[model samples]
Target: MTITLVQGLLIALLAMITGLDCWLQAFFIFRPIIVCTLTGLILGDLRLGVIAGGLTELAFAGLTPAGGTQPPNTVLCGIMTVVIAATNNTSPATAIGLSLPFAMLMQYILLFYYSSFSLFMSKFDKYAAEGNAQKFKRLNFVPLIIVTLSFGIFAFLSAYAAQAPMHALVNSMPQWLTHGFELAGGILPAVGFAMLLKVMLKPRYFPYLLLGFVIASMISFSNVLPVALIGGVFAAIEYFRTREVSDLKEQIKDIDNGDDQDGI
Candidate 1:
């Protein structure tokens, strides 16, 4: 489907806001899952958008930015996943794989933008030396505005120009290749789960994880809301249980200290 210019602009604006939240705002509205769902809603395919977004979230869950190093571009990956899936009738896995390269490219683009923006540091120094608060604040915002605008332009291009090429590529794929991609996509989420477990698993949480798995096994895959609710309840229980334990320990310490004072 061809995106109208106005729709394209709206999408670009959404992308800019989403990208800005990723680092600048620290709000999670720009996460891969959320971005994918939003893109899907915009393109008239919310189901595909949600599935792709959720799978992509799992795939990237183990990654995070660390000092000078940035993770792969989740915003780009999420947008491309929804776009490809909506336009090309591709499996989530195929769309995910297809979007990986572009996500990497976005990472490089961000790096370059940051590096180039650093050239303005001398201007910041001048403003600080002059005690010009207005200029300093404006200079501080320059990188944010530029980066946000760049993300919007990239989103617009993807929404507008990517359809034809992606359609052509999908149409040319052999049946076996298509089936293979579907199979790969089906397993991709497991990889994401494994990676997440690797990072988040601790001896203390092992029992909780096992309990979740056991409860999840009894439910059908189509029903997730129940599972989520049960998990939330268990999490709350654990939180309160831990808090009580800590409070008891603190009281016991207070009593021991009081006894020592009485002896003195």
Candidate 2:
């Protein structure tokens, strides 16, 4: 709970790094689990980080930002969740419960930040259009640093500030409301995921997604065979299958063309 300023800053730095371009093959911050754990180590609470990351991972297990679909704010949640759980000695349920709104807020901060910076993106666009490649490349770092530093500052402030409010809120709240917030935290993000599904999920593929949940539950592999992993695997298969179908159709067209030539 009582982290030194040096320790606190390191966590913020790590959070910024994870939140930054960490968009791996498909997602930003694939390193939250690792980042959060390292942060806990610095904060003198490794176990808290591990447990928080594990639970938070599941809450966000289904929410991957694939293209235009916005996911829950992993940006802040990664470090913030760890801080709350570690500082307050909260359980995964409590910590995970706390992470959702923060994550949602982060999503919009990013969206608005993106939109605002997009004004500059037009500048980049102009340079790109003009074939001013050097200027275009140099201009790119501006937004990158801005986003990274924003998260870094946010994490630093939240680590210290969140302690007071969260402690006060928990102490002052009636048991019922506190419990309700916990439950709502778990449930609220389904709306986000639904938004994501509405955008990216293929109707025909819903069955497979359901099957994934069923299979994981049946085998008691809830965390392991998560919806995101299942969805990603399915997405990959669909991609290849769609390509294969296109190739076959093209081959058929070519054969038909040859037949027409022979007839002539």
| Top TM-score prediction, candidate number | 2
TM of each candidate vs. truth: 0.74, 0.76
What does candidate 2's lDDT look like per residue over 1-264, in tens digits? 566688778877876777775532234444456656766787877887776666566567557666566676675677777777776665655666676667777788787876797689679879989999899998988888887887788778777656788767656767776578567657755765676677758988689768876877677553554666876888899999999999999889889788656644
Model 1 lDDT per residue over 201-262, tens place: 88988987787788889877765677778779989998999999999998898897887566
Off by over 4 Å in 2: 22-31, 125-133, 185-196, 200-203, 221-264
Q: How far off is residue 163 in model 2, in Å?
A: 2.2
lDDT to native, each model: 0.80, 0.70
lDDT of 2 at 8: 72
Which residue pairs collide, candidate 1?
Answer: none
What is the lDDT, from 0 to 100, of the residue 210 in candidate 2?
Answer: 80
Clashes of each: 0, 1
